[model samples]
Target: MARHVARPDPRAHWVLLLLGLVTLLAALSFHGLVSAVGGGSGPDQAPASPAPRAVTTGGPVLRLDGPTPVSRRLPARTLALTFDDGPDPRWTPQILDVLRRHHAHATFFVVGSRVDEHPELVRRILAEGHEIGSHTFTHVDLTAAPGWRAGAELSWTRNAIAGVTGREVTLFRPPFSSTTAAMTEAQYEALRNAAGSGHVAVLADRDAKDWQRPGVPAIVKAATPQGGAGAVVLMHDGGGDRGQTVAALDQLLTRLGTQGYTFTTVSAGIGAPDSMVTATTGARLSGTALRWAQTGADWLTSAMNLLLGVALVLGVVRLAVQVACAQRHVRRVRRPRRRLPEVVAPVSVIVPAYNEAANIAATVRSLVASAYPALEVIVVDDGSSDGTADIVERMRLRGVRVIRQANAGKPAALNTGIRAARADLLVLVDGDTVFQPDTVYRLVQGFADPTVGAISGNTKVANRRRLLGRWQHLEYVIGFNLDRRMYDVLECMPTIPGAIGAFRREVLFAVGGVPADTLAEDTDLTMKVLRAGWRVVYEEGAIAWTEAPSSLRQLWRQRYRWCYGTMQAMWKHRHALREPGAGGKLGRRGLPYLAVFQIVLPLAAPAVDVFALYGLLFLPWSQLALAWLGLLLLQAGTAAYALRLDRERFGPLWTLPLQQLVYRQVMYLVVVQSVVTAVVGNRLRWQRMVRTGEAAALVGGAPAR
Candidate 1:
């Protein structure tokens, strides 16, 4: 009894995958790993506005919320050292070492995202008797950002700090801020909002400009205060190479200490209380979650990038191997050599039909018109409801016979046809395929060498008037035929396509007459013949035209069956890897090639598109476009060469790019579904395509009366 096969809908799995991808991209944007939508910049480059003289000249710390806005200057002979855009793993530690050696205390205004990345550094700053302040998350300019963004930035930084050290900070420094005298109105207004939230805005009075990486002397000169007046010096520990900042800080600290200058935290310099406070439990929990979430997103993005790179290398390597091997095969075929004896042996052609009434008459007539001297045609109708056998019988073509059987499937029908055949050599043809007059003659010529067990003929897509048809035509020439040449050269040809293939009658019986265990009977039988130690070769001169699916749904079904069946066949012949002789060659070479290029590469192919979308969103478009174009051109060159080898027209090459966008994706999805179905141990039924008589129309073959 046949086991019942269940078709499972995989829509839910795909939906979940899409949602997860979207969530990851959103996380990356939020963490500033990718460019955020509408993200604003700092106020450093903005035009200056009128400023309050007292706040500008008096102090670096200000309180703007009280009825009387006030500013207090640092004590005489004292300096408050502040670093922005940290805590970087590199440079920050070096600067801290210098401060530790000098016994100087300073403040670090940390970006929230970086705080999450290096929480231990934040904790160390607080432990070493230094202060921690908010530089706003992602270092966005509070003055230029939307009102809500300013608040969120400050809040997120506070939460990140609280999560790391169990404390909250009230000291805040807006990114790109400088001396109060240079403040724009937008900067002042942003400060007022911070004051409303109980934040002490800390602006620098002396800009060290070490971020420019100027000489250490320049940074020292800029940071020093004239005479004994106290000042707040600004520098950076992150955002780029900060070698100069670290060196300048060490020298500046020594010079100031010798001048009887005292170093203090930002709050203490102005005689204010400590800005750090214990964080709420809720804040700590929320911030920890946010930190881990960002870390996971970072790891995932790294992994995806690595996989994309590996897939690219594999794809390129496969293309190079195919082209090189194909060229070698072409050279060998074109070289002058002694010709083999002409094969005049009688041949039997087997046509397996199931609901193929639309094309059976034309199929039989084409076979009857073969140029071979002695030929017999057999049509096996496997319980076709459309009277396929009756149509063939009415043709009354000479030496053609029709046999009826219960619908036992294609493999069984082919076996029945093999049992009825009388000739020593046999050719298998699909019911919807139309053969050229010399196809049989050329296909049988391979049998002149008794070592040849089977010969695979070139199969072309006949219905090439439509875009879908043209795409398949290109695939046949470029993907299938080119690969066959390479396989033939390697002496491990895998599949003799059902559209047109010839086999010795004894070789068929020796391989157990078309194994019915797998959906891909052709591939299964071919592998069996190879494992039996008989050589299989490809005859490029024999051409058979067959109809390709015209609609997307039909194409999907047909390809899904093909992919799933091929996998099943591969699994069945897996032992060939360890076996000696020709089977081992198929296992070691042909199977691995199929597994990598056909299965694994297609599985990873979607990553290319995903990264392309990522590049469009966050990377330079010009670079991405050039890279994509280079790959497309490489593929086009390969396709052109394959078409030239097959003697095909270049007209279908125009659809190559569109095929990558649409048809290629469909084929990838088919492989994905087939893999998923196989993993779940689901048996797939044989899927038959609707006959359209397109093959007969293309070959100009008239139906038999």
Candidate 2:
């Protein structure tokens, strides 16, 4: 029998989720990993080291104090103009266009990492006859940068510029420093370090301070010449908003042109060749690696964006559909039912037990206590080593029979009980499920319609004293019942759970007495009956108390079997999609929905989780938090509505938010694992959770802990 096969391990979902989590983290964490290996900064190129140490000495301590770092002002009437921290796609182009308007050429000192990201910008600079200078990788204040990193900063920028422009650069600018007067001890040290590395320290004679954004007027005033024949004017083409800098550029150019000051590259003013023979082999390799790492981050970020988009779309659709359908269902069920002929048929209740000694006696006793006048309870012991049969015998109750059988599965056990049953109405239940007094009577009411062959009952969780149990309880009420209300109204109700369902003996027998083929005997059997032209409806008023898995591990095993078996049954009956008559109704109304919402939606749900993590790590915390709260709110409202429909209390909804943190992820992954298992053609066995007799008190209406 199908239910007799090997069951899935409860650990399977965790293993699968763990593997998927690792993969997602890998994608999101790619930049960090690469940065760690290469000893570089992230995409934004923030300083790699902590804040610079305080240097008390004030005035510049560079070449002006001597002659190495700073070059003298060009011959009278000359000006060498330079911009720093540039190649920003947003601001750089604006600065370039402004420079173009004046038909002037200037040097742009580019950050190496930024160049790796926007290599074409470097090429554009060279193509425009603009000189390139090294701004150090990541814009670190080289003075305070560690020993291992300082050299790489300058070398990497030179190589990155050369890699794209095919020309080496000798002009260097120590970040946050200028000519002799403006340099500090740290700045002097950094400039000397650059000279040692064969770089000419390019310091400004005038500081535009455009990077400060002290208005266009302020920047123009700062750059105005001191009536000098030559000067090195400082400005910025990149970093933050450069609108003021760009606007101020045209003003400075006109002012300088009026004063007869000519603009030239930093090297020409210093009287050296603008280009060098080569960028070192090490620098080029570092640049290439940075280029590749950036490319990877780009791809991963794009993938995450795509995933988030799809998840958002699907999530919204689901929420809309569920909310709309649930509202309609609530209103419809609230209306009084038309009086129908009372269903007084005697019911034969069948409890199939396999190592369920824990709750067998209580379940049988609950059936015996049903208010229905005529009742016969039959307990089928499916070869339990645990004295389940002995427990039934100890009850010595009337109208109840125990049929001991070999170790066949649940379907076989149910078949045995059905055969031994003497009544026309049959109620099938698991050993762990206990019923209310009027459950059988209310369940059979659905049989009033001659076409209605089976009725599904409301199965509630009895062990909801813990957080996990409470989550399951919510699932039973919202996920299962809300779905049934919608599907039943659509005339395409699919599953009639094993815990509490009723069927006519004739219809049950026609379906081969509970089908032993699939692990989900209830689902397989239900669809078979539907295909056989029998109508199935859910009876929400017929309540059955069943023990829910109290631990995540147990829940994983049970849900895994349920999800996998459901996939198999869906595949087995897929031909219904093409059928013309009764099966056509199922094919048209039922299968597409099951395929989409069940199979497709679940497989893609993990993307929401992946995107959530990405947003936390790369995007803003506010974005991730808002998105999470919005989803949680949607769920909370939906859960509240479901509880109202089920006549359940609102208190359970308190746990709904926390449930998103863990329980929901587990369920999502279980569905994912099921899809993977089905796609790979793996056979899944029926898995049963260990039963505890705690449900006896719950059925007796004991207060929840």
Candidate 3:
């Protein structure tokens, strides 16, 4: 008996990994690492008490900590140019170029997140003899945020600038703030809080309103101070398109120079010390680490988006191909054909049993009840502790025989049955499967063509009254059978499926019988036959009903084995890629398709789900909901079409959406575990599902005896 050995569950490790990824993405969004899509912060509109007359009428630079506020005006013939919402990669450099050409200096109020992204720009600003100030991390409105958040915003921005330039800034600018006269009470409180931390508030004397992207001429007029009163001018170097800002800066500099106004940094205009001061060693190191961490987060976000886009495109293409090929296959099979001799070859049915006493009686009975005249059934019981062989023997059905053997596993028992059989055509089936009376007869019809070597029969779920069973039924109809039809049309059918498939006796022996190397013996055998120049095809008219796992644990084990075995078989036959004829077609077409849709897609599915959650939480809900609904409708439409093709009722498909939440996740994890096991080179034994004998009852037979 192939018993399962206890091993550490890898689910905890994968779950933790997925959670970590989601957390990182959420953190990135919260911090605003990516640029905003629409525009800069809107103008502040909340009503509040006006500032004191002395402060409002005072110069742009103010020291508000004392009982009486102290302020300073810019020197005569001087203009203090300060840019906010930077260091943008696109517009900042152009503004810097204009300033460099005019030999002018300005203070850049940098957002901490943007500084993390373009640290080199911050360094460039410092190296070029300009000034830097804190614009608050993420460009958040300090007046609207909590006091703690406002404090952290200022601290984070200072650290970011210190990381790049080895300096800390004493000057601060609140997001969406204007001239002192326009300041609200909340804004003043925020400024007072910053003053307590040694930050001097830097309000603008002139509002260029350049972020509005008015014509270049309008921006220039708004920025030019009245009568060279030595005023502080505000503008933008970030936000949306700054073409007007850049053009206005160049023209403003030239036009203002003719008016005898010299542009300089904020501190220089006020005759104060430079706003930037050298930072302590500890701050610099921690800030540098923060910079690198944010950079990595940005890269990860971009890579994930690219991967999701690619997966979406591939998924759509796969669906389109499946529908097209399935339709083609239907037309080809239904077209009228010339009359030919019916195939009545004697057939041997092989049933490999391991602890399958619960299902053996019905399996044997179904075989004996086949309508075909020349049929022999061989039940090979492989060391079953349960009385599997005895159950079949007690039935005493005509043309049925039972052979007992030690537990050498499924492939060895299958080979034993083949050698003892007395017919030229063979049908392979699992012990838990129940067949219709005409299944074997219809299965052999493909043998009428001399070149056809094997046939794959359609497999259905026999215990689909429960939700789990219904989910499996949907998968069988949409995911499996539909793909089989497509594969048949493409002439690259990979596996004939052990639940129900037919093979030629000679073809089996020529390909060295059932392969023992992989757990999926049927797939291994089918590939061997294809490599030997025999065409394997699907016989949809022949159907077998098999028991699907009722519990999640059982489903996980079954799917893990299947996925791992298929991967092994694909690897074992990898040389077919270089071979000529049918082998090449299987390699070039079938293997890649399986790798992308089966292996790679499942591996990527969890990450996609994580991203979808991220979108729901941080992104626009309406857009995300519409996108999810569109995908659901596409899947439901495909499932409906597949069910129609299989002559199944549409009632099972109502559970399809629910399956995405539960069953689909289980399948994804199965692929994950299988891939990890394969990569680690661990050996997986045969996992037998406990049979309920429900399949027999579905076909009008008695339950387990």
Candidate 4:
């Protein structure tokens, strides 16, 4: 007898949200496994789980079987000879030939890199009648992962397959078949979710144990039907040493054929099948023993998905509001009346250096050359083993003062400079950055209004010729520019960015100088300033160009630090959450905007991801069409905004879909990591960003003011 799966409660929305979060956490943890191994796929013919509904009322098949049981009893006699961790030139073709001779179809769960390396093989697989499944970008296990890494494995794998075969792969077979039942449930749902609204059906039984290199006779013997007629068999053609699999399958097919058996594709046997089982609830039912169980599961899943969706949406809306708040506050500033204050007030420029021997002199030189009349350049050398102070002293830069301090972090260094500042206005610059000739003037322009507490400058990528550099350049242009504009409109500038920013000396003191422990001291200060009801402004023309990471390793480290720091900032300001008038200037505008842009948007991203992967994998033309339409509109809107900003790069814009393959996961990582760090009170000491060969040299080229 088929057992009835217990249903979840209708009001279990919170549970669903928790489940979603758990799934997200699982995805992050299983990232390496998914990337290095693969995820599992649902039955190819299994229609996409219906779109979320208030009460889905179609088929009466309400008996929920455990996933493993469902996979075992799928009413198809055809075998899905799925070989994971492959695209190997040496062995895949041999297996393909054997399948061809028997006129049999199989599924190949291909790794992303292999697909790229051997596109022709992928093309051949698709053309020859075998279905393709994602073995992750590099055969990663998606069951025990968290953050961007998990999302990357799923998304990148899908994208690579799509690129090679032009087919949207819906099924993912996890490598090693290693996920526990609980882990599988979370991972399958998350991958489905990350794929954008698709359901993944995991295989129940493994017939041919090929990964172990069992002898050909053992392989054939294992696959020979032992239980009832219908069964889904698994075989391998990848992940090393498959010659035995090739020989075994040939003999198995011949044996099955001689036994008066016929081979059929999984879909061919099931798609549009005549007989169908309908499970229905009786009309007189008032939450019966069975009815309750059916509705319970539906209710639980629905509530959870809905709540998570709501939380994600709310977070994004908050960020948007924050951006809008910043803009409004900046626009509220009255026009400057007097020219340069006649007897120009002295503005102190603080340069924070820690072993910045290669670039400190240039930074000091830029400050000394600043067109602002009465400017003091204070270089704080934070215990550098290198002659950073010596270089500053050797330059003999006029109006520049060098201060030696112990090896303190950026925030500490900033505080030292702030305390020593002899002027009323203070500007903090990283030692590795350079400023435009008019940077200081522009930074100080916003100080005309007494209500303005701090000013942030426009930051740009100085080196963008390399591929990685171009990618970073595009990121700065689109992400930062959009975020800044939105923040300006919202009125809460998260931080007067440290690269080139100014604050009133008194205002700095009011906010208690720079925060020493937070990785993003700049952001914390900006939030604190807003929480105090003061405004932060952006000087768009005040350009400061800094070197972006030039390689993947450097890029990863830099981003990890940034994401970790941003999480820290969010935690410190979490008091603003839903509190009436809790955020001061930011609460009213900035906090709300940021919640929308940063928090909600990323969470919502999985929705888009689920919808997209569903459409592609299941070939649901209608749903796919709708999702694709939405995606097109989103791109159109983003592109228009990018164009309006004059920062449009045709290549990045064109690769939007592909970029999303990796981009969404990156955002998800930031979100997941932030949440975890918040809960654990994770503390991170600042790690200096690595600057590779040319990147190191290019730091010297930034134009001194």
Give the best candidate by TM-score.
1
Evaluated against the true structure, the overall lDDT of model 4 is: 0.63
Quality of model 2 by C-alpha lDDT: 0.77
Please list the residue runs of candidate 2 whose C-alpha ends up more than 4 Å from where it truly belongs after superposition.
1-23, 26-76, 88-91, 98-103, 111-117, 134-163, 166-203, 211-215, 240-244, 275-289, 509-513, 580-607, 618-626, 679-681, 702-705
Candidate 3 regions exceeding 4 Å error are 1-16, 19-34, 37-41, 44-46, 49-58, 64-70, 75-77, 100-103, 214-228, 247-260, 701-705
Residue-level lDDT tens digits of model 1 in 489-521: 888998999999999999999989999999999
- Prediction 4 TM-score vs. true: 0.54
- Writing each residue's lDDT as its tens digit, candidate 2 over 439-533 gives 99999998888889888999999998888889888999988998888777766777899999999999988877788777788988888878888
Choose 2 or 3, whichever is better by lDDT: 3
- Estimate the TM-score of every prediction: 0.93, 0.83, 0.92, 0.54
- Relative to the unseen true structure, what is the C-alpha lDDT of residue 693 in candidate 2, on a scale of 0 to 100? 76
Enumerate clash totals for all models, in the order shown: 0, 3, 0, 87
Off by over 4 Å in 4: 1-343, 575-583, 600-611, 619-626, 629-633, 646-652, 693-705
- Candidate 3, 177-198: lDDT as tens digits: 8888787777788898999888
What's the ranking of the predictions by TM-score, best on top? 1, 3, 2, 4
lDDT of predicted model 3: 0.86
In model 2, pairs of residues that clash are 60-183, 77-229, 78-229
